[model samples]
Target: MAVTFVLAFGGSVLAQEQWVEFSSPRDGFRITFPGTPGIEDVTWTSQMGYALPARVFTVDRGREHYSVTVADYRGIEKLGIAKSQSCAPGAETCIGGQTRIVGPGYWKSDVHGAITYAVFMLLRRHGTPTGMTWNWAEQVEGTLLQFTNADQSRTSASIYMHDNRLYVIEGDVPKGTPEPELFKMSIGFIRPDGSGSNIYSHRFRISAACAAATLSASDRAPASRRPPGRVSGARTFPASPITFRSMARLPTAARFSRTTGRCQSCGGAGSSR
Candidate 1:
C-alpha cells in the first residue's frame, strides 16, 4: 500500500517549524509532530459502559490544534478475530483451533460507525449542527467526518484502527486554517516496535527515503559549483520511484501531483521534481 501524506498550508506566511517523533509505548503508536506536543491522560467511556483509558497528545500552533487521541482496546478487543466456518475441520493451518478471519472492510465499517455516532453526540452537546459531512475511503484506509457546530467552530476527525487500538485524529481549527483536510489526515500511527505491521514500517521508510533523496540531491553539487553562503540551487533530481496506485483512487483534491515541474504545493522552484 502506498501511503499518501497531506499537508495543509494556510496563507503565505510561515512559522518556525520543526518535526520530531513522539512515541507512546502505552498506546503502541508513534507519530511525527511539527513541534513538541503536550501529553494528557483522559478516560473514554463507550456506549456499553466500558471506560477505556486513553491518552491525548496535542500541540497548539497559532489557531490550529493538532491532537491524536488513542484509545487502547486490548483489554477488550472490539473487532477481534472470530472462528471461520469455511476452514476444513482439523486442518493443520487452522489458527487458534479454527480459521481466524478479520477483514479490513469490516474493521472500517465498525470503526466508522463508532466515529459517526461520536460526532453526532458532540453536535448534540453544542446544539444542532449547521452543516456536516461523513466520509469513508478504502484507499485511505480510514473514515473522516467534518462538522460545523452551532457556534460555527469547525471540528474534523479521522479514525483509523490498528491492532486493538483506535486512533482518533482530531483537528480543531479556525475557518482560516488552510487545507483543513490536510491537517485532519496528517495524524499517523507508527508501530511501537516497527514490526507486525507493514503499513507502519512503510510510512517510516518512505519518510526516510524522501529525506535522503532530498539530501542526496543537495549534495550532488561540488564545492566549487556551490555559491558561497548560498544553499545549492534547484537541479533535476531523479523522481521518486515510488508510485501509489491507491492514491490515484482518491479524489483530485487529495491526490499527489506527479510533475517534474515546480511543486505546486510549496512553490519550491522544482524542489519536488
Candidate 2:
C-alpha cells in the first residue's frame, strides 16, 4: 500500500527553485512550474451522487505543491451552465433559467454559483475550510478562493469556465512560503485553435477611458458635480471597438496594468483576495 502523509503547511521551507514549463494538450492549458509535474485522472463525486471527471497535474517543489485541475462538465448536470440574460431597460434584474446553450463549445459563465459548488465539493472531500475569501481577475472573470485545511495545508485556487470546461488552478503550500502570489499567477490557458478573445477586458478598458475623459471634461462645481461617464460634450469613440492588441499597445506598463490587472512580464496580477 502507498503510504499517505499530510504535507503540513507550517513545515514548508523554501530552497532554490527551478522553473519548468508544463503543457496539457488534453486540457488546453500551459503553466510554469518549479519542476515537471505528475498527472492523474480523478473523479469528483457530487453531493447528489453524480461523478464528474477531472484531470489533475501536480508538481512538488521545496515547500509547495503546484496543481492544475481541468474538470469536464459535458455530461454533468449538477452545476448547470449559465445562460445569458436579456433584461429590460428599466428592470432591476432579469429572469434566469433561460435555455442554456449546451454543447462542447465553451461559453462565458457567471462564476459565483460555480465557485459555491466548488466550495461544497472541497468541503465534502477535505473537511471544513479554515479560511475563505473571494477574488476576481479581468478578461476571464474568474473566482479565486483561498482555503486552509485542518491538516495545516493551505490551498489557493482560482476557478475559471471556458468552452464548456472548468479550470481549477491550485497551489498548496506551507503557511510561510514566499511569493505565493506568483505561484498562483503562473497558470494560463493554452488555446488549441489559437483563436480567443477577452471580451470583458475590451469593454472595461473602453468604458474606463470614456469615464476618465468625462471626468476630465466635467464643468460642474465640486459639490454639485454629477458622476463620471455622463459627459455633456460631443465625443467620438472608435466605431470599431478596441481590441486586446490595442490594449497591449497602451503607452506604459502601469497604465496597461491598471486596465487589465496584469504585470508586464508575468502577463497578469499575482494576488487573490
lDDT of 1 by residue, 76-156 (tens): 333223322343555433222321121221322233345554565556654334445544332224566666655566777
TM-score of each: 0.47, 0.49
Against the hidden true structure, what lDDT does model 2 obtain? 0.49
CA lDDT for candidate 1: 0.48
State candidate 2's TM-score.
0.49
Q: Name model 2 segments beyond 4 Å from true.
A: 1-16, 46-49, 76-112, 123-134, 194-273
- After superposing candidate 1, which stretches have Cα over 4 Å from the reference? 1-21, 77-113, 125-140, 199-273
- Write candidate 2's Cα lDDT for 25-88 as tens digits: 6676667777778889998543333367888888877568788878765454324322123334
> Among these predicted structures, which one has the highest TM-score?
2
